[model samples]
Target: MGWAVARFDFSWGDAEYHQETLENLKAAIKSTKKLCAVMLDTVGPELQVVNKSEKAITLKADDKVILTPNQGQEATSEVLPINFAGLSKAVKQGDTIFIGQYLFTGSETTSVWLEVDEVKSEDVVCVIKNSATLAGSLFTLHASQIHIDLPTLSNEDKQAIMTWGVQNKIDFISLSYTRHAEDVREAREFLSKLGDLSQTQIFAKIENVEGLTHFDEILQEADGIILSRGNLGIDLPPEKVFLFQKSAVYKCNMAGKPAVVTRVVDSMTDNLRPTRAEATDVANAVLDGCDAILLGAETLRGLYPIETISTIGKICAEAEKVSNQDQYFKKTVKYVGEPMSHLESIASSAVRAAIKVKATVIICFTSSGRAARLIAKYRPTMPVLSVVIPRLKTNQLKWSFTGAFEARQSLIVRGLFPLLADPRHPAESTNATNESVLKVALDHGKASGVIKSHDRVVVCQKVGDASVVKIIELED
Candidate 1:
């Protein structure tokens, strides 16, 4: 079964080649059909130099900076700053910098363009080392960035992120530390202008009191919500975090949007194990009907990243066993009873017919996974096999339902053609070319091969310009 898991802290700096790492991650997701989206945290945008002294730094482009602090401290190395000067050889006022995997620009301030080449790597090592310590709390296993600020969101930054997301076929965009409804609107409009807002959803993080008050409005505009309880607890009374979490989850569920509960469920970033309280916290969040969960330091920089994911998965599975699945399913299913178009009506009818005929499998050929998803939305008892050409669609579908399966185009078309075309097929009448496809489906045990001569099978496909739904019977 395809299940969506979002990789929260997928850093390009940590990997050798950022683009290659992303491609490999995409490939892994495609193979497993499990990873729903890669939520890349814009490290530079969120990174701020809290303390900078008047020190000249002289370093050539691509030169490495190694910081060795005074008196028995560890040394850390950061890649030399990449700027317009390094890339294009000539720096400009509004040009952006693409260094390694990070992007910086002078749009926010001209001072950003000033070269600090004279400052030796060791002279400013104290500042660099201490900045890590200052930012350490935010990197903790349960830490969420609450009051963090981005230097600025320029059009170039927005377009860059959006283009990458669209090209990667990401299902959701999680705006870190979302504060207002306008922020949600701005993201929506940007994606809309890019003409890639169909199935791509935008999730807003509510991390403060002001965001909490306007949560409903934000939910109305956004596709989903993430409750960053750690930073949220900073603004409100610590004891109130649980209450606020419940409220956010309830609101998201009410609005039919997915909500993710994040924070230190396992305060074992440095340690190899989770505390008893952390286990309970994870179990409680699952009981609260969170569609997904996010792990920060635990999964990123933790000593036991794999273990953290496994433990959380176990807790969620166990909680789901005892939780009210029926209630959750009923609440989450959103169907517009009245079909708005011919294709939609046909899709809806095919699902009903499949259910009525007690089909063992609902096989669908789709380019976008839309038809299969629509059928899955009805919560049919049968498994749905979604055949598509795009690997991203296959991966994205994993989050939608547990019974959905995906097959490549070659497997669905070429490999199955002979079985589908056999004349003595019992799965359905061999009248149409696509009906033969059902023979291959039945041969593979996706559908029952032995059916009474009068038994009906519903076939749905888009032939040329028209979407057709035909009910066929077994040929004796």
Candidate 2:
């Protein structure tokens, strides 16, 4: 994870600060001087407090409260309303509910706990188990050992995608609580309906048991995966999250898709330094070949956002130095079938050739960014320079966002430098001579200090129906 990824969780606060925070982060670059990727996290079927009274309700242990499945109801100690309409049916008697953040271990009051006492026709009776101040019109709810029956895309989620997400031209959208491939498809189809908005990549946030069960299909449909350990810990046994993350990441590595691991440094949200366990967690993710690591509360509401990023970034770099990428590549080859696809064959060759020749960089000219992504899957030591030419339909205008957006979307993938390029000479079709593409890629590499005179490089591109791979030495 060279550059950072900023994820906006829509479940907590109003949308007013989203645009401003987005602009600030878009302008902000990492120590590597690369722009970060922005991801919009939807407020998917999760339940929330609907304290319309705009006042905090103070609750003490053993206090009784009634939960109603109504929106915008005034909050009181006697009766509390949640945004979800199916609360009564979702939880049964004796079910435990945790409200707010996940920073608690034991005897901590980071969250308000409730126990369901009775389920009436339209209300749920509960008793507070701890003393905490409940915010007005805010706070997310999670029921232990219960699956909240809900759709993939909630009404609020759909509205956010079309309005805030589309208008902001975000680089990524992560569908929360993705149960299956169809759920991923539904989000993609909804974004596609917005026309140009479809440029954004959709990632599935695997949080629930259903999502973990159907990860294979979801992986195929999603552009990437976000291992939401924070939420998964709540949905499943805390111990199982560790195993699922490993399995999910290994699958993503073989598939050559970006996989992001989140909440690796949760303790850093409160402490300036990460706990020893947290530090090891960050290193293990990098050694496991995770494409990126996401910092949830560590950056969202942390005391030291900059320090937290620096700490994780340094850990990733150090771990990468000792990582056995060649072993991973060899393991991956065992999984690939005979007679590889054109893209896969060429990409694998590009990486191997780069390593064999001690190439300073690997360059790829792609229209869909597939070649670059595949090359990254091989985990070559050198970075991949991907010159992507965006494919536009007849009605769309030719502009920066077209090709640039596609390039930016590639930022999340490991070891890829995406650039939008126009061939020196072009015909009616988007395809250009290999020479023209090479010029743009080398020019970028040279300008970025990644290439210099006499440097060796591996180049790859599509030629007609086939693919081409070559090792070339740069000249003045």
Best by TM-score: 2
Per-residue alpha-carbon lDDT of candidate 1 for residues 1-476, written as tens digits (9 for 90 to 100)? 12244543333243334456578767886796442445544322332221132133233333434222232323223432221111222222232211110111111221121222333433321112111111111111111223323322345446546666566555556776577788778777776676444455667877667678788888999767888765575457668889989988877655545678877554667677778888888888868867677876565567887777777878876775677644544444443434345655665567677766765455665554556545544434445555432222234535222112222111111101111223233222224645555565545542335344555556666666667666665555
Model 1 C-alpha RMSD vs. true structure (Å) is 12.7
User: Which candidate tops lDDT?
Assistant: 2
Candidate 2 Cα errors over 4 Å, as ranges: 1-4, 13-15, 26-33, 52-64, 70-73, 76-78, 102-107, 127-137, 390-392, 396-401, 423-433, 452-454
Error at 372, model 1, angstroms: 6.4
Worst 10 residues of 1 by lDDT: 409-418
Task: Tell me the tens digit of each residue's lDDT in model 2 across 115-228.
Answer: 999988989988899888765456677777677788879988888877888787788898888888999898888988987677789999987777898999999999999988
Deviation in angstroms for 300 in model 2? Answer: 2.4
Task: Score residue 287 of candidate 1 by CA lDDT.
Answer: 81
**lDDT score for residue 320 of model 2:** 86
Q: How does each model score on lDDT?
A: 0.50, 0.79
What TM-score, over all chains together, does every model reach? 0.55, 0.89
TM-score of candidate 1 on Cα atoms, chains taken together: 0.55
Native-to-model Cα distance after best TM-score fit, residue 129 in candidate 1, in Å: 23
RMSD for each model, in Å, please? Answer: 12.7, 3.2
